[model samples]
Target: MRQFFSKCPVCGNCTTVTSYKCKSCGTEIRGEFEPNEFNNLSKEDLEFLRTYLRNRGNLTKVAERFKISYPTAHSYFNRVLAKLGYLQSESFHYAEILEKLEKDQIDFSTALSLIKEEKEVKP
Candidate 1:
């Protein structure tokens, strides 16, 4: 089976599921059903989310599993958070934090604490 996309590929607009069918009973239902949050994510994003969760929200483990740098994993995490409407990009200095992390100026725990402090300050 293929993944269901919630956006129109041609026009890049949101698409609604208009119908459903039961394979066992052959019963059909139709409506303008909104896709869930996970449905809005791409396959790669979903995989990243799953890995993050499986790792119990440990970015270091996620990075090792994905064979990416810690900073890159952090960036991917922020991107996912932004996509899910949990973060406002301009509110945090993600680039600076990532750069600092990459340069070994700050550890992961410190970087996370800084981000958490910023979030609390903003909201």
Candidate 2:
């Protein structure tokens, strides 16, 4: 199946869906519809997301699977989070840091440093 282009070829702008058709029922809907954020993700980003999910968000496993460093995997993970609108103005919380440590996404030292940094910023 051919994938629809989410971006306009000429202007390089995001394209909006104006219509949809059903293959079997011969039904059609026409209106201005916004594409989801997933549509904005590149093929590589999707692949990375898939790999990360398949590994259950374990950065160590993701790094090993991609033959990259742990920090690199973490960086890629953060980038995906940003693309998905998960990383807003605030940094990761203390619970999130502990969760990452539990999931082996970050080492104990890294988690500690992040917690320390967060503490310093807040207090």
Candidate 3:
């Protein structure tokens, strides 16, 4: 059986499903079935997502496991997050760090030191 292509061959528009047929009994029934979104994910993206989850969202561990650099692992993770609509802005990261500091999980001195370091790194 030929797999259904999502795009029309002639015009490149999205192809619509109008009907369905059973292979064994020749039974037919169909109208407007939604394709599963998961079907749209490439195998490599799925594998990356799986490995990322398996590593408990640790980029360092993921990099080590895949023999990639930490920056490469972080880039891949950020790309996936962007695809999934979960990417965070720099402001959001700063807010999260502030929240951690407020909760006493990070010391105020450490937070101030990081802020000073970030300022120094800025052009």
Give the whole-model CA lDDT for all candidates, comma-separated.
Answer: 0.85, 0.80, 0.69
Off by over 4 Å in 2: 89-123
> TM-scores across all candidates?
0.70, 0.67, 0.46
Among all windows of 10 consecutive residues in model 1, the one with the lowest summed lDDT is 87-96
lDDT of 2 by residue, 14-97 (tens): 899899999999899999998888888889888999998898889899999999878667766777777788875345355567
Decreasing lDDT order of the candidates: 1, 2, 3
Tell me the tens digit of each residue's lDDT in model 1 across 96-118.
68767888999999989988877
Model 3: residue 111 alpha-carbon error in angstroms: 22
Per-residue lDDT value at 77 in model 1: 83
Q: Which stretches of candidate 3 lie over 4 Å from their true place?
A: 1-30, 88-123
Error of 3 at 14 (Å): 4.7
> Which is better, 1 or 2, measured by TM-score?
1
2 versus 3: better lDDT goes to: 2
TM-score leader: 1
Question: Which 10-residue window in model 3 sums to the lowest lDDT?
Answer: 88-97
- What lDDT does candidate 3 reach at residue 25? 98
Q: In order, how many clashes per candidate?
A: 0, 0, 0
